[model samples]
Target: MTRKLGLAGVFLISLAVMNVFADRSDKEVVKRVNSIEVVALDSVEGYEKKYRIPDENLNDLFAEKIDSLLNSWYIQNVFEMPSGGGMQDSLPVVSIPDSVYIDRLQAIDSYVDLSFNKTVKNFIQLYTQRRRDQVEMMLGLANFYFPIFEEALDKYDMPMELKYMAIIESALNPTARSRANAVGLWQFMYGTGKMLGLEIGTFVDERRDPVKSTDAAARYLRDLYKIYKNWHLVIAAYNCGPGNVNKAIRRSGGARDYWSIYYRLPRETRGYVPAFIAAAYVMNNYKEHNLQVRYPDFPIVTDTIMINSYLHFDQVSAMANIPVEALEALNPQYRMNIIPAKKDKHYALKIPIESVAEFIDNEDAIYAFKRDEFFPNNEIINPKSSNSHHVSNISGKDKVLYTVKSGDNLGYISEWFHVRVSDLRYWNNISRNLIRVGQKLAIYVPQGQADFFASVNRMNFAEKQAYKKKTPVTKTTSASTQTSADGKYVYYTVRRGDNLWSIARKFPGVSNNDIMRWNNIRNANKIQVGQKLKIQSRS
Candidate 1:
């Protein structure tokens, strides 16, 4: 009887061990699913804090929603793994009650249940005081853009939630430009804009035209969706590129979903999709976060008219009895208030619908008045007069009207003139860098601005200051000074916040390419934050 009892006890112990192993397998699967990160909740919390939302109830609601969304069983399945036979389990199960999983779920629940308190608390911790002010300013502008974005997305059969893309891209600023030269509300780079049929030129970048840009963005998003067959990946590709997404997928070993491949993406790309999702969530729950929309000063109703003449927006505004600010807001693409010099083709002009008839009635009179006002000094209006005066007065006079020769382009001309292609275009109304043979080009060899040159002469200035202070002259000079051959030329030391365009504009006659050449820069796009250059005198 004693032997039988001992055998029974051993059998029961074996059964218990098997049961434990099975439980472990289940837990491992849960662990893997929990590993999937949901970045939107944290981002929303940060945004909310930055905005200083005081309402407790609204904050709680957002928190609750975020928790529900993030803590779903689907997310767990994706992130965690099952546990069973210590390394022998075929299917891994997540370990339930793990601190990470429990805490994450609890945090989500806390956000939902705590009302405005959690959101406000999260917001306060997320942003600094200055950022909070910027957030407030951004919220004011959101009213102007959100409606337009909503309408455009609706037309494209896209989700209304996608309107938040503009908020993330530009804070709804139609004229926003990124460091990479991505412009306007959609933040499209030159290449991508061109691909989407957004025309860019000196006078107008269609990327800045809100209506057209939005349309292009919608179509681009649709195309991305068609390629990836996923809205999340489409948003990711919008920030980084479709190629990047594809590369990330490959890196992730052919993981088909966003979270699975997110870690394999570039740092900025990883953040971008999450930021977008967060923006969508926050915008939808803005009221909960105590965000109030400040209505724009202009009326929503507007009209479009066809304009054949080379007209100024200011003139159109005056003729139509519309405020210049409103007109500018409606048509941000006109960089200098004037439309591109079209000879016969008509361009669409947006005006207050009520003002359309008034604009038509006074079109001729308005054009005449504007011409008179702008050309009050007729001598200054004539390019020939200015050129003649420049030739006669300026030293280093070289009279060369070089008709563009074959194989000659803006870059070649810029290299020849020691000027940037950008500056050549600015001076000569050249819309693009492309130049055809027989195209007449103007070359200006600046002369005689000793004082201007002296002002930027870093070596002499630095030596003089050092002498005055009776300090020892020591150490290597800055990059800007080093580039100057004689150490007598002016050098613009690139500061932390300096850019090529701004630095070029600071000194007269120094073209963008001149700065590049002075710095021995191969690619204009690759300038670092603190790269300096010599400033050769243009005058």
Candidate 2:
């Protein structure tokens, strides 16, 4: 059943997100993200104008996802950054001289060059100055992961300082995923992870296993070092791959050193070495720059239990008294919170040291807790297999129109409507990020509350502001699912702890996108108090 909410009249949201061209005459552009509001210069009564300096060279090729990193299961559930006392309030400008940085670099013992240059200086400043809080968080996370890294690097007889590459690769986040599809702390692409003997299967992606990925990364670094004995060239190759590194070397007329082939390297590769050097410097000399080490609250001691049967985190939580979040933090390799341990193959599960004995005592009970529900038909539903990605037999998004309003940029509108900026452009045939006032743009959204999204066209500035308050969004978000006419396909109502990932697992062939379409949501659909998860058969 396609249920549509009976939203009242024609209120509006301006289709134009906001224009970047300041010289053009347009209505005020307002950017709202969650609770934060950003108004364009000269658009608001008390606002003042500002300008930005351009830097085409050495722009962030490896953008840091500090927020996402901090939001990972390991940090959110297992760790806490207790409030830093007002010590941060009364801080003197902390800037070390270039010579001091050079001295510190020379003091450390490592096989890498550890050379100082303008690019290295800039990146060091980025960690020390612009993102101190995030760096502090990384420093704290290092307490747990650094030992594993050191052990792996030592086993390979590689420079221990090379561990800093994880910081640059993922800010030491186990779940970090790049826009280019590289994933985990070591940022391994699917092909690379597969080639390196890291298992990427239905229930597990070993790329996210800190220990496995770290060891694999060390092996990879050693191989690169073998190909090119110079660490700098090895680092460059790690970033852009050996093919690009070879091209850069060839382009530089057979130069063997990193600096000699620097200009010939890809723009991102040029910054990779410098960023790695800066990361190394910051991790070592953070205290000198008035940065405090945030501490990880995760258990310092843990024990591993091998499983020869299929298991779910819920089962562990119920039997071992461990929270699912902690289980996820400990075993990120289990993509579905499931350990698909077979009779011939066993899988390792980590628990706090105290719970190990109890877990071993009740191991049978844990596996049998909700066996039928979890492992339907006593078989693991491999989501990676063929037909796992749902392609709707019916069209998903219904098209609606919104007139481009003043101050609209592609970003603002995309954010407002819960659609991708790229999708918005592709749908409207937009060539660039710019949008003109009063241009009619087609917005494709689920049919349930198309009225709310459609309101963008008719509402005025004040009306849109009032509508944008978003306080009563609960009314919209609580839109429930009604089964299809024949009731053949299964439907799941949202629950408090239920997320798209977790919910999608219940339906073997359903994609998260299909679930989003059915649930009348665009991006994030928080399962509120009134929300329900409908259960039906997939006919």
Candidate 3:
């Protein structure tokens, strides 16, 4: 079985390998990429999860996140994205030569190789020509995010130019989530995020935490750099993983650089490095292309306050005179708009710089304001005292017919029914959001929850909003919480793997001692699953 390869055999093998890579050049990069059949990677095993770009033309994400923002003095005043409501981008286009791009890229001081190529040129045009609106939006966000990224990069001794990677990954949107569930500015999937020490749970997802996620991203890039010793390869590995990059290296016959092994990588990742180059080019020279950078009108200064007790956005809003929207915008990490802090464990709450002293002075009132209503464990009520009725688990098309109240809009109705606004409109065959006071709308909910949703039509506006506050509890919230005429207590049905202390933490200012005393439980550990405990909520 052992036969030495002759010189002729070795020559033929080397020639075949060279010919294969010769065809995998920029000749097909721009014009023929669409025709390249999508590669199936099911066969390659044990590779880490990918957080690749969803599209090279990343205009839609900026538009969608920008449009979804509600009335927050922080969001509305901070980021003013184009309304696209008949107003055109008024900037005149300025076309530039490829040599100009090459020279400009060289001019920017960077340790990473910013070499020019046709693939890079194609991507640069994609940003400058086609996605200029998005470029402007990202340019604005970069003003807010770049300094955070630079600090992390500097701390890790990574190249300063790596900050542009955020533009490619998330358009500098801190809350940007990818199709692969990769969230935050750096597009880190849950697995990679948790690997990099990001806190992910029902309450807080630090992947959307700008500073923490940027730090995580910088550390990850540094580790990848240790492996490849090349920034371009490190960038490619960040899109896919080191496994894919290593696979590409093997298939490319030991080629080390990006372009040499580029064809052997995933199709999405093939454009990744080039897209980074494009991102860097557009971010730096967007002004030269006549693109206007609409920076945020508000100041970016913020101060972090330590939360040692559980806190709700409403409480802070009430006591500190800060809008809940501003609190949420500043800290998108809190999924339920609640800071789930405890005596032992703490989380930081970011407030606008001006409100730092104000918040600290009124911190006690903020924590205690309606603490019993938000956190049910604070005061216990007798189960027998509550007029809570049994909710039957029913099947079939469970529909709730809701009569629109005077102030009800499609957005409010959809949110009340836990359905999409589009779903509400589609179900009722209405084109616009317009609805009269007596307009009947059918809301289809999960098969088991017909009676619960139907009761919304009878509730007053204040009660409906009170019901809305309980929506963050997911399946654990009782259907009868807001349905009772008195509405004295919110019932919490304990789930498996639950304990008194853990249950108490869900509500701010509630402790296990409070839960035990309120529930009248002799022992804290004696509570069973499916046991409903009453926590007081005022009508």
- Candidate 3 Cα deviation (angstroms), residue 45: 36
Ranking by TM-score: 3, 2, 1
What's the C-alpha lDDT at position 37 in model 1?
25
lDDT of 2 by residue, 1-539 (tens): 01111112212222332223235333434333222223332344422222121112362554456546655555544443222311132233366675677778876676776766557777777778767767877886787689989999999999999999898888888887877888888889888888788899877899999899999999888877777777888888788877777766666556676766677777777888888888888888888887866544344356788899988887888787664655777788999888999999998888767578789899889999868656767887643232332222226766788888887777667645655566777788888677899898887876554755666566554334223212112132224455667876544456544555445434423333345546665333355544655443221
Q: By descending lDDT, how would the candidates be arranged?
A: 2, 3, 1
Q: Compare the candidates by TM-score and give the number of the best one.
A: 3
**TM-score list, all predictions:** 0.48, 0.59, 0.60
Candidate 1 lDDT over 1-539, as tens digits, reads 00011111221111111111123332131222333322233234543343222222222322232233223322221111112201111222223222332233334311111122232233322211213323443454565567777788889888776776676566566776665678888888887777678889866789998888999988877767666666667777777777777777766556556655756766555555445544544454445445433323333456787776566665665466564445666777877666654446666767755567788898787766546444344211322122221112324734345566555677656544434455577667778576777787765544432233232222222222211111111123344444456755676677653455445545444445456656777444456655556677543
Candidate 3 RMSD to the correct structure: 19.1
Model 3 vs. true fold: TM: 0.60
Give each model's clash number: 53, 18, 0
lDDT of 2: 0.66
RMSD of candidate 2 to the true fold?
Answer: 21.8
Question: Highest lDDT, which number?
Answer: 2
